[model samples]
Target: MRHYYIYLLKPEIASNYFGKEWLIYQLFVEGETAKKDLRTIAQKQINYISGTIPTLQIKKNLDKALRIRNDFYVLKEHYYIDIKALESKAVLKDHGNMLTISASGSYQAETVFFEVLRQINPAFFAMDFENRNYGWLNPVKQVNYI
Candidate 1:
């Protein structure tokens, strides 16, 4: 249930939901990983709050800490996933609670899906897990997803 704040990547001038016109904020992102200092990752990057870079470490760093190792879910054995198709319908939210999980055997598919959502051009389109869900914001009267 531990959480860390992570931001999404978007071009400059785009609006973020963290109440700031700029796109940098430490919102709740769930993960099992922890570090002695959070500043190291920030140091490696030019600036999470100032650059146009997509704040990639949100996933990259999480992936590193998760240590997927030899458990890549096999996808389709021979046929690979059509990433473009999956990404076509998803929309990345400005702020979200990202959760990283480790599974094995039959649960591998679930892990892949989580990682996939974190990737793609826009992160996530729409999803609901437990009570924590996505695609709902105060400014918008209704929740919409592509």
Candidate 2:
């Protein structure tokens, strides 16, 4: 079994025109080093998925950490697609802005997941095989013969 993870990056800083708080939604997909630079893969994912991008309102003196909560809402909504597909057959770990999903099956599922993530944001992505524990912790579990 192989696992694929996705992390959404929220805007860390905002401009004065936006009142020092701007929310940018980015998607990070795990695995498949070769297709990461491809743009068509992302477009295909969007054509298949259903959802709207979330909106945020920033208030004065709001703590930067608070923005994470808002980002979770967006993540939660996006995560549902995978949840519906895998159901209890997979394990899911939510670490604020990051989500780790694991399932038992061929690598095709991972490819599809990556496509979806790319569809969300082609600019935000990182791949790691060794340093998986450094950032946010979100894990999903699955079982299958690989």
Candidate 3:
């Protein structure tokens, strides 16, 4: 069985800054050898996750975080989880890994899940959150690779 590292980010308290508010980020690292490239993998992952921001300071911090370690920190308002995907159902080999984002209120929880649909897939997209009643009634937004 292939090995994978699953990371999850959950918000401590939901805010109204961005629509539904809950903000979370997850990453999956595959292969036994993939751990050796964690830093590079993390850099690519962060860049892919952060979207395009017009400022250099944010970019620098993102780069710095990725280059340094496996365990990185977000703001004080979020939570994180890093686990090994061991079972078939537990692992989403298609997109990379699964990321679940949850918020604190009644606005419907936004879950941005991902998987490696194909072993050599080039892009990423968001799957539905596990629970639909936590935030908005509409479908979760699809975030494609930039």
| Best-first order by TM-score | 2, 1, 3
Model 1 C-alpha lDDT per residue in residues 1-146, reported as the tens digit of each score: 21122233333312344234221222221221225355556444423433332335544543453445332212221111123323311112223333223222342344344455445434222223333444311222233579
**Candidate 3, residues 25-105: lDDT per residue as tens digits?**
223222212466775776565444433212243234334533353332344423222322321122122222332343332
The 10-residue segment with the lowest total lDDT in model 2: 14-23
Model 2 steric clash total? 4
Clashes in model 2: which pairs? Answer: 91-140, 91-141, 100-140, 102-140
Query: Model 1 segments beyond 4 Å from truth?
Result: 1-7, 11-97, 115-146
The segments of candidate 3 whose C-alpha lies over 4 angstroms from its true place after superposition are 1-26, 29-33, 51-146
How do all the candidates rank in terms of lDDT, highest first? 2, 1, 3
What is candidate 2's lDDT per residue for 51-114, written digit by digit as tens?
Answer: 2222221111112323333211224333312333433223333444344555454444344444
State how far residue 69 of model 2 sits from its true place (Å).
Answer: 30
